[model samples]
Target: MRFATVLAVPATILGAASAATTVPVTYEPKYDNGNFSLLGTACSDGQNGLVTKHYDTAGSLPSFPNVGGAFTVSGWNSSDCGSCYQLTWQNNSIYITAIDVTQQGFNIALAAMNNLTGNLAVQLGRVSASYDPADGSKCGF
Candidate 1:
């Protein structure tokens, strides 16, 4: 009886852990110049320079083109700084680093937004998304 109880507990925990949380996802226009400085972010002062170390610039377009994001304070806490989240929209998904805080929803860089929307980010500024804590490997940790 004891062994069965322990087994059941583990299974229940695993089942709950596998569930992803859903949120609204929007795009911000800060990556256009390829500048990934953490100067104005909430994590700028305390994340051990993780954002600067991992965020990379890709192009000089006038649109966001990076794999970074800001989460709403109500949904994510300070401990999530420098963490990664997999954002899914429709049939697309992308991994983004949490480097800042927003007022509402997950505000991702435009590049990540475009990817998730199949290059329709301009047409679809916001989308409903399912998010899960993901391996930071994809976001360069």
Candidate 2:
């Protein structure tokens, strides 16, 4: 019985460790040209092209531009770029590609913010959300 109890403890700990991580989410208005170039996007050059082709099939601007990869600014790297996550806020969820890194949480695109907030982006500039890894095959994973 003692061995079984010990096994349960490690299983519980592992479950907690693997749980989805939640983070703050904010919005950024689109650039004048309706692109994310001015923000010094890290993945805009090549990875973004692949991201767009995979996710932006509706002919709309890509969503979820900024992400706190590894949950820190300095922690972000090329490997984190172009990663995809499913962000959940309230009862809404949206898939976002990690085009840039941010220390202020996941800085989403304005269009995505609107969609997630039911067109309340103007009223709610920031919110708490959780993210989980999505299928990255389309993102060249």
Candidate 3:
């Protein structure tokens, strides 16, 4: 149960060019070949029973309207996975795939991001996320 709490700014504030909204986003650590929890999903094929990764899907819990599958990123649209986005904090920035969404999808483990552990929450400089075309990148978002 590793998690990192991040402040998401509304896309409106960024400009009309985007429609993303402000929401509290928490990212957890995920590993390759991990099992899908009741609210979990997978990024590759052959992993049945779990929802296949999709752009429109959000890592929502099974209790949500479409059960284990629903593509809702608060301010983003469905079928928007094949896009590339940037997450910036302080002087660090990482490019991520808008690839998989889960009701409980783990983005990147907080442990890898920072060495500290134990469910800690920290405020980062005006966190900004922006999206662009995926450009044929692989390895899942």
- Counted clashes in each candidate structure: 0, 0, 10
Most accurate candidate by lDDT: 1
Model 3 per-residue lDDT tens digits across residues 45-89: 332222343322333321111112112321223354333443333
After superposition, which runs of candidate 3 have C-alpha atoms over 4 Å from their true positions? 1-25, 31-77, 102-107, 115-141
Question: Of the pair 1 and 2, which is ahead by lDDT?
Answer: 1
Candidate 2: Cα lDDT at 118: 86
C-alpha lDDT score of every prediction, in listed order: 0.64, 0.57, 0.33
Can you write out model 2's per-residue Cα lDDT over 1-141, one digit (the tens) per residue?
A: 355443345666778855767888887664212433423554443433424334322123343332323243233235656667778778698777666657756776677777677888779888888777777653234
In angstroms, how far off is 7's CA in candidate 3? Answer: 36
RMSD of each: 6.4, 6.0, 15.1
RMSD of 2: 6.0
Q: How far off is model 1, as Cα RMSD?
A: 6.4
Ranking by TM-score: 1, 2, 3
Model 2: colliding residue pairs: none
Q: Give the TM-score of candidate 1.
A: 0.68
Q: Write the per-residue lDDT of candidate 1 for residues 1-141, one digit (tens) a residue.
A: 355443345666777845767788888777434665665566554444334444334232112354455554323326666677778877688877676677765887776788888988889888888887777676553
